[model samples]
Target: DESIDIPYFGELNGIQLVNPIWVKAVPYNVKVVGANNNVVTHLRLWSTEPSKKQLVQDEKYLKMVSKISESLYPDDSTDEGKILRLQQQYLFSSAGIQDAIREHKALGRDIKDLPKYYTFQINDTHPTLIIPELMRILMDEEYMGYDEAWSIVTQVAAYTNHTILAEALEKWNIELFKRLLPRIYQIVEEMDRRFRLFLKGKNLSQDKINHMALIGSHDVRMAHICIYGSFSVNGVAALHTNILKEIELNDFYQIYPEKFNNKTNGVTHRRWLMHINPELVNILDKTVKGNWRKDLSAIKELENFKDDESIQKEIKNMKLAKKRQLIDVIYKDTGVKLDENAIFDIQIKRLHEYKRQSLNIFHVIYLYLRLKKDANFRKTFHPQNFIFGAKAAPSYIMAKYIIEIINRAAQIINNDPETKDLLKVVFVQNYNVTYAEYLFPAADLSEQISTASKEASGTGNMKFMVNGAITIGTMDGANVEIVEYAGIENEIIFGLSAEEVTQAYKANSYNPRKIFDNDKRIQDVFKFIKSLDKDEHYFDFVFNNLLNVDYFFVLADFDAYVEAQSRANKLYQDEKTWWRMSIMNIANAGFFSSDRTIKQYNEEIWHLDTIKL
Candidate 1:
């Protein structure tokens, strides 16, 4: 504890000071229980600790150091917050790298052999700094040459690209980076110089080389550094990987085609299935006896029982019970009573324009309008409850606006007697892992309707799929693979294909205004949204975004989404068919298990030898 001394940035006498900041390594024992036994793994959490002398004399230093471990992903709305975020990233990377090297040296292994024994998987752009940090240790600390350290660093690290959004790929301003981390910035600058020389040797055009450069005019591209420094680069889903190669990171792919690969995302059935939905687990136990918990592939046997009436009845009853559980929670939390018998259509993810929470709510408005005006339509329609759970980032204005609109819409629809019985909207407050445990099992229709090629791969989609929720989604992210596994007919798939969405963006041919003008239903929904816009401008942002600059194609996909919703409602009316489809979804979800994902990673990327306990 407090064993690592890191050079930290501060200001004294109106001048920058690079002083030693002591850090503590807090250890946690994580027990992984197996069938016969359990293994203990140590997780080291790094925390900043001021020296005893500094603690008594320098309150500013104490405050500065304490901020590092106080919270995660702090509000980066101010300059202070932005610097703290970068500091947090570097703290984690530097401390972890130092610890790893120390452990290897303690084991009497040569520093050059680090790659043979260990590998670092950079989850996303957040940890890309690990590349430079590792290089710094190898070259500066171990006194290795530039070529030797670069070779070892590349061999030891791999990157996983999690987003197609350019903003998600982090870029730090060069001045701020150098100020916060002077030595690390020097290493990064050197890395950039060598990489530029390497790129030029390949006979690349100046424009292309500049585009791929790690350091741009004003900032350092973290993702570009990750790609250049890592041995392998992967995407989380099949479509996501293809997008990375053919479009997003095409230049990098052109240079190193062998580096690109796909490892589709997955969820643990132990948690999503067995742990959450015990009733469904019991039904599976009775119908198909196998070690499905240990081996999710055994769940595929449930396909044979899809047509069994007794099995279907058990599944239906289990789903109804889960819905009732969710209804109670909704009533307790929001004072909103829901019809447990109504189709439980749920969309719960981070609130974002690209994720299309607006599209989902717009459909709700359309349905509300239809229920009020058309008696004949109301007579034929089935009752449904729309549930949404999400939290927007503090700095994201539009996302916060979407949240406000959803809550306001929930207030209006849930209070009105005319549509209250047939249609109910509930936005669960403070949604998190606990809320998801309740939502996933209760969902009858899972909404995975992100815009095509926008979502990388949604683990929530996998969670819902395994819990027997039929998906109503666009062909994006893991929804593509989910449809392949669960059978396309079972899912109500809609909207533009990823290729079409990409092409429309490239050609600038698609217009949300055109779609808004062409369709009366979309017009009716927008009118409803406009009606809600008061002095607060709660719905004004939504109206302008959807009509004027719908980058995620919410308006473009509106008609297809509604059609898919109708198809889902019609299928819900047919109980036997719906249950059979639900069973099939559960049966096929075995493919998307975390077991398979990890196995693929170990085989293709990490290649670490297993040690038996």
Candidate 2:
């Protein structure tokens, strides 16, 4: 389809617009059968080939796209790879903006009104090329003046900051920008020159001026470009927003205080609760009045049944049934037999040093040592199954080593007859949303133990809470907000606050070696980990990093985390008390709903209206 008629609000009857051909959007489930005929599924996005004829009406564009597409991308860090990435960014942004302009013209509207009809929310710096691309189109192609183009672009654009990690922030070399996108580069240069002059005119200090520069040290900061070009800028959480203003983007905040705001990230309660836990939904429907599905806040009524023995018994039953489902899943997928009655303590997320799966494994090693050292202790200790699910980036060496250590530890522990029934470890393969549906509803403890001030806002934290899992976390990211909502008593929170962590970094005071040396239990765990039959060379990096780097303060906070885990375990022995706390977690989780987050974005930032279905 070359063009299609869309119902556009106008004095005219019909507006012909470029037709977007919707292709296959389903996820491809590739089943890999092993030697034993056991099957494992790998889910990936379905890909489509570019249509040579349909991509452009002009033969020149078709040839241009084809030629650029043929270029090799070596690695993300290489200069050549960066250049290729910019070329791809320009291709996508230019096409999308051009289509919007073409559609606006088709509706018999002026380009000045583009802001009224269209809004582009750039999720991150990936699509930042759209800023200069839009400016170039208006000035060169549309023959509009620079000031006019700039005004419309700013009016229709917004940016959201997802991560505060320095390495994650995107920057481009000035030479690369000039070579690949000359016209867009010229517009960017102009914007940078104007931004510098604006800061100078305000009588800012030399240091502050340099910090605010769009182009600094021969690199074009994409984040600065985004902040300058967009009408609104926000962080994913309240704490993250404050960090942006107080430190990360302080100069930008000084200039545009109104632009700096917070819209904490949220998870879709529909899939997390309604679809994942239908039995719990049925229980909620019976206990609570009004439509809780449409408006999650109505679920607060569950707090009334928090202490009801019958409701608590039903909650335990629901958890048991979900655990049985997970047991079957683990057996079929990984061939790991699990005790359905054992505590399903889980940590499922992207494997990263900051997220700290290594810390979780270290605690598992500590528990294993305790069981092995004393027979009387092993008999009295509660049975626990530590379940982990994550995939490390291919390039993250330390993270990959952590995954290997987990798997090897699982093999050693599960094979030991003395510990097989008392304590078990299982690392689920190929963790995805499908697996999450089976695991979250069964979780007795949710591991959200990220380093303080590193995690922006974890949507996983909210998902676990909504599904009735008690969070054992530090005061980081949305965990602080979670405790506030669920009540501090309900969650097992430990370690430093964001302020304390920042102060420690400033003073260079944290010493992982001291913690490792002073604690006797830590020594025993380290010895046990060493004695495990594994290749020393493979995990040398993990040992060196923890002993030396300890960048995420894993060792520093180990004792507090262990203590919190003990507290949670002790409560678990009293089934009624634990289920009461679990109910509170669910009842207080309504505020973290995506419905509420979207409404906040609509009202505070986007200013769009809701259309009733």
> Which lDDT tens digits does candidate 1 get at residues 1-613?
4256666554333223345354443334355565444755556676666644333337766777788878877778888998889988888888778878888989999998999988999999888889998888877778888999999999999999999999889999998988788777888989989989999999999888899999999999999999999999999999999999999999999999999999998898888888889999899888778888889989999999999999999999999999989988889998999998899999999988899998899899999999999999899889999999998888999988777777787788888889899999988989999989999999999999999999999999999988899999999999999899889988999999999999999998988888888899988876676667576454676778777889999888888998999999999999999999999999999989998999999999999787666
Q: Which 10 consecutive positions of candidate 1 have the poorest summed lDDT? A: 11-20
Worst 10 residues of 2 by lDDT: 4-13
Instruction: Kindly list the per-residue Cα lDDT of model 2 for residues 473-534, writing each as its tens digit.
Output: 98888888889988998999987777887888899988888888899877776666666655
- Return the lDDT, model 1, position 356: 93
> In order, what lDDT does every prediction score?
0.87, 0.80
- TM-score, predicted candidate 1 vs. hidden true structure: 0.96
